[model samples]
Target: MTTQKIAVLGPGSWGTALSQVLNDNGHEIRLWGHMQAQIDEINNNHTNSHYFKDIVLDEKIEATTDLKEALDGVDAVLFVVPTKVTRLVAKQVAETLDHKVVVMHASKGLEPETHERLSTILEEEIPADLRSEIVVVSGPSHAEETIVRDLTLITAASKDEETAKYVQGLFSNHYFRLYTNKDIIGVETAGALKNIIAVGAGALHGLGYGDNAKAAIIARGLAEITRLGVKMGANPLTYSGLSGVGDLIVTGTSIHSRNWRAGDALGRGEKLEDIEANMGMVIEGISTTKVAYELAQELNVYMPITQAIYSVIYEGKDIKEAILSTMTGQLKTEDEF
Candidate 1:
C-alpha cells in the first residue's frame, strides 16, 4: 500500500483510538477538533484529556483546530464527528481540501430531521464526483475497549474497493482486525440503526430482564435492520455480517455503550432530557430512535423494537406499557415479514 498522511477530524474517543492505530503504523497524522481544549490536549499534552481520559496518545499525532491545516498534505481523511454534526464538519473540510482525499467515517446514527445516513450526508456535503472516495468503517468496536488495546474487528465499506483496502491496511493491528466490503449502504444503515435496538436491549436489562429477553430482542432487532436494509438495495448478507449482527451483539450487551446507558436510565424511571443532560456526551440512540421511527413510517417497514423505544422516548408512553404492548400484540411467524 502507498504511504499517506492521515488527517482525523474529530478528537473524540473513537477518532483518538483510530489515530493512535495509524500513528503506530508510522503514518504522519493530523488531528482536528472543534474544541480548543481537545486540540490543545492532543498537541501539547499528547493525550485526549476530555475523551480518551486515562489513555495516552502517540507522539506522531499532531493536533490542530484549523481544518485546513489538518487537511493540508493529507492523503486520506477519517471523519469521526457526531452524526448530527456531519454536514457542518464535512462542509468545513471540503472548503479547503483541494486534492481528492479518501474519506472514511466511524460515526453511527442518522440525522433526526433528515433521516439521512452519514454517507448520504457526505454525498451532499462533498462534491459529487469526489464522493467515490467516501468509505465507512464500522463494526462492534467500542472506543473504550479499543483505547485499552482490546481485540476488535471492523469493516471498511466503499464503492471503491481499492480505497476500502487502503483503510483496512491502515487500521489492521495486533488487536485490531479489518475487513473490506462493497456493501456501504447496508453496513452504514446497520451501524446507525443498531444503536436504537441497543437502547431497547439496555432498557430491558435495566428493568432486570434476563438473558433470554435480551437475546430475543436482539434477534428480532436484526430482523428489522435486515428488512429495511434489503429494501434499500443493500446486500442481505451484509446485515448478517460484522457491521450488522456483530455490532448489535456487542453494543446491545456491553455496558460501555453510552446509548445503552442512557436507555438504562430511562428504564429506571428517568426522563430522556434528564439522562441526556447528565450524560453530557451524545447518546446516539436517542436521535437514532427518532430517525429510525420516522424512516420506518415512511418506508412502510415493520420495526417493532425500534417503535417501542421511540414511543417511550418521544410519545411519553410508559416504558412498561410499550414493552407489554410489544410482547402481547405479536403472534406472527418469523418469516411473516
Candidate 2:
C-alpha cells in the first residue's frame, strides 16, 4: 500500500493510540493537539506521558499545534476529539483545508444542543467541497489496551462504500483489524448509546450488584439501543455487528472505560462535578445519556434502561430508586423491539 500523510486531530488517549497504529502501517502521522507541552513530549521524547505513562510512540508520528500545519496536503484527516468540541475543531479544519481529503471521526456522542450525531456535526461544520463523505470509526476498542498494541477490532462505516473501505485499509494492521460497514446510522448510534449502558453497568457494579445484574443491563440495554436506532432509520441487523453489541460488551464490562468509571463513582454517591473533575477526561456517556434520553422521548421509543440512567445522572434521582422504578415498571415481552 502507498504511504499517506494522515492528520490525526486530538492527542488524547484514543488519538495517540490511533496515531501509533497509523505509524505502524508506515504512514506519516501528523498528530494535532492544543497543548504545547504534550506536543513537545511527543516530538522530543517520542512519548505522551500524560496519557500513556509507560508507552513510547514512534518517532515518525510528528505532533503539532498548528491546525494548518497538520492539515497541510494530508491524504486523510481522522478526528478523535471530544464530542463537545467536535464542531469547533471541524470549523477550524474547514478554514485550514484547501484540498479535498477523506474525513473520518472516532468520536462517539451526540450533540447535547442539537442531539445530532458527531458525523452530522462534522458534515455541517466542514463543507462538502473540502472533504469526502464522513466516515465513522467505532467499535469495542479502548485506548488503554490499544496503546499497548493489544489486538483490536472495530468498524469503519460510511454511506459511501469506497470511503469506508479506504478507512478500513488505512488503519488495519496485524494487531488491529477493521471491518467495513455501510450502515453509518446504526454504527454511530450504537457507538454513542452504548456509553450510557456502560455507565449503568458501572453503577450496578458500584452498588454491589453481581454479574447477573450487569449481564441483564447489557442485554436489555442493547435492546433499548436497537429500538431507538431502528426508530431513527438504522438497520436492525447492524445492532448485531461489531459497532453494536460488540462495543456495548466491551464498554460495559471493561475497567478501562471512563464512562463506566464515572458511573461507578456516581453509584457510590459521588457528585457529578466531582466525578468529572477526578476522571480528568470527558466521560462521553454522561452527556450521551442526556442526549439519548431526549432522543428516545422525541422518537417515542421504549428505553427504560436509558431512562433510569438518565434519571440518576440528570434528574438527581437516587441510584437505587432509579433502578427499582425501572425494575417495577409495567411488564413487557423479551422481544418487544
Error of 1 at 288 (Å): 1.1
**lDDT per residue as tens, model 2, 1-337:** 7999999999999999999999999999999999999899999999988778899888888999999999998999999999999999999999999999999999899999799998999899999999999999999999999998999999999999999999999999999999999889999999999999999999998899999999999999999999999999899999998999999999999899999998888888889999999888899998998999999889899999999988887888889999999899999899986
Clashing pairs in 2: none
Q: Find the candidate with the highest lDDT and give its number.
A: 2
Please name the candidate that would achieve the greatest TM-score relative to the true structure: 2
Q: Count the backbone clashes (under 3 Å) in each candidate.
A: 0, 0
Error of 2 at 3 (Å): 0.4
Candidate 1 C-alpha lDDT tens digits along 148-227: 88898989999989989988998898889999999999999999989988999889988889999999989999999899
